[model samples]
Target: MNFKEKIFSILSNKEFDNLTWNIFHDQIKNNITYKNYLQFLEINPFEIKNISEIPFLPISFFKTHRIFSSRTTDDYDIIFTSSGTTGIKSKHYVKNLNIYIDSIRNSFEFFYGPIEKFKFLGFIPTNRKDSSLIYMIKYLIQQTHKNGSHFIPYHNYKDIFSNQNDKNIFIFGLSFFLLDFIEKNNHLQQNMQKNESKNKVIIMETGGMKGKRKEIIREELHDILKKFFCVKEIHSEYGMTELLSQAYAKKNGKFQCPPWMKVYIRDPEDPFIHINNNKIGGIDIIDLSNYLSCPFISTEDLGKKINDNEFEVLGRMDFSDIRGCNLMTPHFLEC
Candidate 1:
């Protein structure tokens, strides 16, 4: 079905990228119901002769039922379980996931340039959560280690920072965990001299001022991260568990979508309408890395589009009008 040519053709061309997204988006929005979606997949079933036959499974459907397009379990390199706002588990079956992983690695290289190997610090949630920062950080650490890191720091942020006067250090942290670690260990904070002329460091944290504190100004959070880590600013990572690629912004920064990930702004008043660049609207993402699963996802995030490949994430919707994952569970369980 010329699958390789078809997929790459769309990804390789700027016009084809947007064109495919438009068709894919319309298919989902026009009929997102389970019954209708099955029909859609039936019509789009993988045909070795035709690229139009390849079917993509909607991620939400995985919560209730398995949606493996592969013929056997051995076909998958690994399975990733997606966490919900509630604790209910949803496993995403990945077939030939190597392509997805490679795309991700290449995208990071394209965006951040080359990353030097160094001591890796992880401050991520051990348990299940809707956010996939923990999973993504683990991958980042592994890459650093494989390429060349003196060592990966997994414990005692205090000790890790004590002997860190030299060497290029790369620290990846979670927002809340990092905050608590900093507050408890003031000595670590006091010992570090702010702004070293030759010190090379990168502190990348994902997620935001959601659960940790009621509200945190983006600039303030960036300042606090810089002070605590003795870095310039907190390099924030924007990604979802459901997405194959991640967007990165430097400390106290906004998100810049990677080459493999394309973001679009949909009108807030009408989800089906695409707003002009710079308008705040619902966030839609199309990630080439999400190929093994669903590459297109409509999110509840309120954001403004800056360009073809950049956005300013405004934050989640308020509680008054729409309940989050917890409130929506009843409806899902009913299915």
Candidate 2:
């Protein structure tokens, strides 16, 4: 079977390991940029056997170079760009759009049951035209193909939550936009308190509070949102332009990855050292679904692994450019 077939077929941990090794080898051979990156590091691809030994290309490389694993330049189907407000944006040249579609659908279903069970309502500010987050949201909403499942303007916050459907309402918005909505609609708190439909609402923030308001900690942010939205817990999506798969945080800012994706905490000063347990460090991602592009990426975000199945995104590392769709760096997590 092809890499695409084998990747999605991953079930067991052993199977994931085998496929990752296969993809790593394939990328070193076929992906010119990755091959040169390993060569410059004086690392022999043949000597690498275990997953930890493999070198993760820095995510910044995506901005400076075209990170793709194809023999020719014309092989990509679409490019997914970052939603950064300043500086150069990272672009991911996707070879197979189907892989991304499947990744979004499968990842969502893995976390929240079936897509058909929820009516997706979102307010995605169009800062960038080729936004990966927008594409994911649009694709999922379209898949439901229901009458009430669609994007709403910022002024229509009441209309967004007014859907009285039986299906669970999955409301999506950028971190800043969600905050803006609630602040302006303080009446929503009083109104929603009386409405029985508030129980069906699920508010999911897509990060990015930069430049919009004072950056606050996740705990405080969730507290405000919970009070305003009248929900038990606030949901958050952990994703980027460079990655095909996403991890979801259902409650208390703790994120859980799907079977095909994994997160590792690496030492902030020393990139090679992978920290264990709750020690805060830079995040190294092994997104097996990012096969076409670079699967192994060393992101600038700081985080800690809670356990084998869970992790927490603390914030971004210092000196990194402030980008959109990124959470606030709490003063405490900075320590």
Alpha-carbon TM-score of each model against the true structure: 0.72, 0.91
Best model number under lDDT:
2
Q: Give the Cα lDDT of each candidate.
A: 0.56, 0.80
Clashes of each: 5, 0
lDDT of 2 by residue, 84-138 (tens): 7699888898888999999998899988999998888776775555888989999
Model 1: lDDT equals 0.56
Give the poorly placed runs of model 1, Cα more than 4 Å off: 1-35, 38-62, 65-75, 83-90, 116-119, 126-132, 146-155, 161-167, 209-215, 319-335
The CA root-mean-square deviation of candidate 2, after full C-alpha superposition on the true structure, stands at 5.9
TM-score of 2: 0.91
Q: Model 1 clash pairs?
A: 1-48, 1-49, 45-53, 233-251, 234-251
